[model samples]
Target: MSVVDVSGATTSRVAPFLQGLAREPIVWLIVLIFAVGALTSEYYLTALNLENLMRNVAVIGLLSLGMTVVLLTGRIDLSVAALMIFAVVVGVIVMTEIGPMLGGRWLVRGNTYAGPIIPVILVALATGTMVGAVNGIGIAYFKVPSFIMTLVSLTALRGFNYVLTNGHPYYLKAPLYGWIGDSKVAGIPVSFLIFLLVLLGLIAFVNGTVRGGRFYAIGGNEKAALYAGIKAQRYVVLAYVISGFCAAVAGIVFTARLKSVDAPLAAGYELTAIAIAVIGGTALAGGVGSPWRTLLGSVAFAAGLNLLAIWGIGNWYQNLAIGIVLIASVGLSRTSRKKTHS
Candidate 1:
């Protein structure tokens, strides 16, 4: 073959591959993170370290998954992290105070308070859902901007968190908490398993349900969705509700892992969740992402942080890196979107 023909054939073959990678940067980002992590430290490649990494990122994973759903519906929830902390705090209080009335006894061992685990779990879920419902109602019914509404919630909840505990940490003791946070089945961390299960169910829900489609439609263009007879307001509310519920679940996992809850326990986690969703290829403008993508983003993000820690990078630098990555990802997404439209 002529030299030109050879070049043409190679270009044709490689073009599609490049396009595929562009369409799914999270995949390559994850590969890159793992590669960097393996090179940065001898311990990074160890089985135990990787397992710990997965377990630790489970909370962020859940939060990011929830953020992705909210982003899909063209909304945002800045209060999720605060809600997580607040919900867990409420749950623990319910277990410690309300449990006694319900015949649940507490045995203090050192600084940890032991009580019935059921009340904590139930109250946390309820607290999260209630907060989420309020957020939804304000945004959907009152037509409040999502950012403003959630920001207010974030502030209020954060203050309430401190009020509930008087700026101190509350340590709790429970077998189920330990199991959910630390135990493993067949060598897999239970926290990671829970994250995986939620990921799967969310995938089914967002991709398989009619309401899920409505979320996408509203996100893509609310006016058109409304014209099509889709209830945009209801779906938007549902999205925030889901976000709140996910935050609550994450709070449970986080409190379990630490065996404690504090005002600052999950401070700034909402930003991490947004970073995860955006890095996972979810468009901030909405209607262009999935749970599977968020999973890859979460893994990549966790791996990157692990690598940074192994390299002894400081928290300030890590935050800088997150900001850089978030901006770059959004830029790339917007560029790709423009190109597609053009």
Candidate 2:
């Protein structure tokens, strides 16, 4: 074969590989980070640390899932972390104040309510959904901007967290909570297991259902979707409701893991959650992204944090690192969009 023919063949072979990498930039980034982390520290790649990392990041993973859903609808939710704190606190307060009235006993010889754990979960989820509904109503019905509405919710929910807890923390000793938060199955953390189950459900919802498709359609072009008879406004509200429910789920996981509820718990988690979603290749402009991508993003983010801690990095530097990653991801997303359009 001539030299020109060989060059063409080589290009044909490499082009597909390059395109694959482009399609999953987050996966490559994850591999790179993992390689660096493993090389940098002997402890970074250990099983114990990896397990703890998964467990600890589960709350953020849940939040990121919710953020992904909202972002898919071409909107932002800034209240997830605050809502998380508020929801768990509300759950704790209810179980404490009302458990006795309903003949619920303290199960673990401490503050843990042996009363139906189901009610506590329900109450927390209800609180989150209520707040999310308010946000959705304001944005979808009153034509309020999503950012502003969620921002208001963020403030209110944070205040409610403090008020409900009276600026204190409650330590829970519930058996089921401990099992969900800390127990392991075949050496894997239960919290991480919960996160994985949620991820699977979300994947099916977004990829397998008509309603899920509507979310993407609405996000892609609200006016166009409306014209297509998609009921864009109602879907927007549904997106916020899902976001709220996810936050509440995260709160439940949080309380279980720590066996405690506090006003300040998960403070600033919203920023990290958004960062994770974007890093997973979810476009901030909407109409693009997936739960699978967000899953990769969450793993990458948690790995980064684990590496930073292994290196004895300070908290301030960690925040700086997250900021840098977020900006880079956003830039990459924009570039990819431009390339696609081109």
Candidate 3:
């Protein structure tokens, strides 16, 4: 009886409970929202709506992929949406002028702006890569805070988008473009198929590839990584570039499917992507997450938002809900980390 301490008993009892709670907050949130969604709307669980929900999210979902890689290194890219608009506009212009020369014509839904599938894709991906290079150079070599650097680009890129569009939407009249967005493979949107392919590829890159593991190391401690002979700067730049390429890929799919290109196609999308990255358990401080969690996180986020839309929640209220969820998730993540540390 001389040294029996109540603290030891408390620690033993609380640790397991806290550990389980910490392990999967996003899963809990997803379950809770999904159940609520099912109860509120009769159409929530329908087959057609399910397809639409997944297809609609594919764009923002794509952005989340890039954001996942960037956040791992404790950086952010605010210009992603702008870059998307730029890519869409550029691709559409190239397609309309050159498509006829290469046996392309607007056929789907009475639109015809996409050129040859292969060339359109190459141009879009290249544009995205270039944008990422600019962003990376600003952050890595210039020693600029990612926030400031990306914001400047966002502002400037929006202007570029406006310059290209002249405030008008460009429609693609090609059957190919329409098919990319609306056609199905084994009964799934081809765009959705593209998303799955890209997501899976990225999952492998972030989880299995050597460069992926090194990204985490760069995020965790640049100095230590440098000491370990890791080319931290080069990899970091590559991350931004990859992120850009992802945005471009998504852009090509979106423009092709919609048969339309506009300056505002992806407005406010970066916020959604950033939110998904955080909710998926990626530490804002960097070095604590991956693509698997991000993939689920994107689904959870898009599903929840769609639930609100289906339930007839007002747009303003939807934004409020998003804000609330984001704040609460971050708070919960912080608490979980503290408990784990203690």
Candidate 1 Cα deviation (angstroms), residue 40: 3.0
**Comparison by lDDT, 1 against 2, better one:** 1
Write one digit per residue (lDDT tens) for candidate 1, span 1-342: 635688889999999987976777567777888887777678998988988898867989999998999999888999999999999888876667765677766736533568878778889999998899899999999999999999999999999999988888888777999899889999889989998989999999999988787878988888999999998888888888889989999999888899888898878889999999988888888888898889988988898888888899999999999889888888987887788679
Candidate with maximal lDDT: 1
Query: Distance from true position, residue 163, model 1, in Å?
Result: 0.3
Report the lDDT of model 3 for residue 218.
86
Error of 3 at 123 (Å): 0.8
Give the TM-score of each candidate.
Answer: 0.91, 0.89, 0.86
Candidate 2 has a TM-score of 0.89
- Which scores better on TM-score, 1 or 2? 1
Please list all clashing residue pairs in model 1, or write none if there are none.
Answer: none
lDDT of all predictions: 0.87, 0.86, 0.81
Q: Write the per-residue lDDT of candidate 2 for residues 1-342, one digit (tens) a residue.
A: 635688889999999987976777677878988899889888877888988889867889999999999999999999999999888778777777786787765434554455556778899999888878888888999999999999989998888888876787777765788898878999989989889998999999998899899999998888899999998888888888888988999999988888788888887889999999998878888999998888889998998888888899999999999899888888988898899879
